[model samples]
Target: MADGAGRRVDPDVDLRVPRDRREVAAHPAAVLGAIAAGGVLGALARAGLQAAFPHGPATFAWATFGVNVSGCLLIGVLMAVLRAAGGGPPLARPFLGVGVLGGFTTFSTYAVDVHAALVAGAPATALAYLAATVVGALFAVWAGDTLTGRLLSRGAR
Candidate 1:
């Protein structure tokens, strides 16, 4: 298969080395376990990121917004690659989606952001974030589907 640089690699075996990238071909069980592990780590990381930046009261949830958007992007890529390969989820989907991304990006925090925006009479910001999150996440999902659909079809042919 070709890599990001269009370099060829063996197709018979997975040679991905990065611990994170290894999930690209990791055993189903290991993938699930890693997701479980990543979940704990992501949760702790979220708390840490939130606590480390305590400058603003209710107006600054940039961390949550950033995390959610980033999570959406990462999941989009991972989900595309995995599902493109027709891989089983057993743990992959749950680990990445439910465990890691979900933990990293707290909807509770998002709700707080929305509530604060309204309380501060900035309904536009709140509405925007809500619309952005929903629309952006859905776009990410669709993008993943489109890319993966193409990849899978190519592989099939």
Candidate 2:
């Protein structure tokens, strides 16, 4: 097959690889292993944070909020760097992005925290936490992406 620029393309080749090189597909086991290892570390870190800063249902879930926001920011930065660097090893995204960040950021816990707040007769706190987390995460991602892009572009020049 030929790409839009009229270069020959191998259908079996991993798109992440340059066309001039032989495509080396990552073994499924390796990918899964990376994810699992990263997940363990991420989950442990999150658990430690939660344990260190336990919060009642009626109060703000600062630990979860911090973890989620930082995770979002890290993901944005990681993605930008990966794109700018033309990607990385096949295991990089699976290990760091999906596994680690996915594990570290707890949407399920966020939901539970919100539910607990509501159940504790703190509807206003629940609503506030929900809005803050969503908005803060979005803004953090945007900030990280923008900052990384700018820095990378400057270094390129």
Instruction: Name the candidate that leads on TM-score.
Output: 2
lDDT of 1 by residue, 9-118 (tens): 32112335233346546575776676678789779888887777653433546667667777767666665566454444445655766577767877887887788888
| lDDT by candidate, in order shown | 0.64, 0.79
lDDT (Cα) of model 2: 0.79
Point to the candidate with the largest lDDT: 2
Poorest 10 consecutive residues by lDDT, candidate 2: 3-12
Q: What is candidate 2's lDDT per residue for 25-101, written digit by digit as tens?
A: 43667777877888888899999999999999899999999999999899888867766765555567668876788
What's the TM-score of every candidate structure? 0.61, 0.84
